[model samples]
Target: MRVLDRPTFDGWLWLDGYQLNKKGDAVTRRELFVQQAGLRKVSTPAPVPRRGGRQVGSRPSGQPPLVRRDRG
Candidate 1:
């Protein structure tokens, strides 16, 4: 599965079609290859903003807005 050249537009090269290589097969093989390769689409989990009734915008001291410095 080598991309011979860059796409005409920039985004993501969605694997929605089949491709032929050095072999002589000409049949569309996208689904077959994806299934064989155990590849599937997945959804990413959303970030959990706050927990235990803690406000995401303020600290427990009830002072000014808390700055989110480190996300690491």
Candidate 2:
């Protein structure tokens, strides 16, 4: 679905009243389209943010963060 307008002004786009977003790994719009629907693009957002909030690498305050180190 294409976002004709951002009435809500959130990061999410209106998938013609459904919704379309690529947030994290639970499941994405592209995955859903690949499984059942077809993917297409009319006009996408002009500038997808270079750094998402967490991508900035700053941990939340007052929280002891335990991170997992991935093996290459």
Candidate 3:
């Protein structure tokens, strides 16, 4: 992602990037609104990992993934 504009006074940031679709079949340009404090500046962009096969940095086998339940 690239910073499209300076951060707002309230700490919101505007970003532009090409993101993969949910099915990972397509890429589209998108604008994102995110908190500036949640972002970290990286000296270099990391390589995009290939999809499928064994999951990288994932939980051990046989362990169920954690799910967040929202209390409405």
Taking all chains together, each candidate's TM-score versus the true structure is 0.19, 0.18, 0.41
lDDT of 2 by residue, 1-72 (tens): 334453544344444333435532233343111211344457745644445567455678898776879999
Q: Order the candidates by lDDT, highest first.
A: 3, 1, 2
Each prediction's Cα lDDT score? 0.47, 0.46, 0.74
Model 2 Cα displacement at 44 (Å)? 39
**How many backbone clashes does every candidate have?**
0, 0, 0
> If the candidates were sorted by their TM-score against the true structure, best first, what order would they fall in?
3, 1, 2
Position 23, candidate 2: lDDT: 39
Pick by TM-score: which candidate is best? 3
**Candidate 1 residue spans exceeding 4 A from truth:** 1-36, 50-72
Of the two candidates 1 and 2, the one with more favorable TM-score, higher being better, is 1
Q: What is the lDDT of residue 51 in candidate 2?
A: 54
For model 1, how does the per-residue alpha-carbon lDDT over 30-66 read when each residue is reduced to its tens digit?
6222222355457844544443566556576757775
Candidate 3: minimum summed lDDT over ten consecutive residues — where?
A: 44-53
lDDT of model 2 at position 56:
52
For model 3, the superposed segments whose C-alpha errors exceed 4 Å read 21-26, 40-72
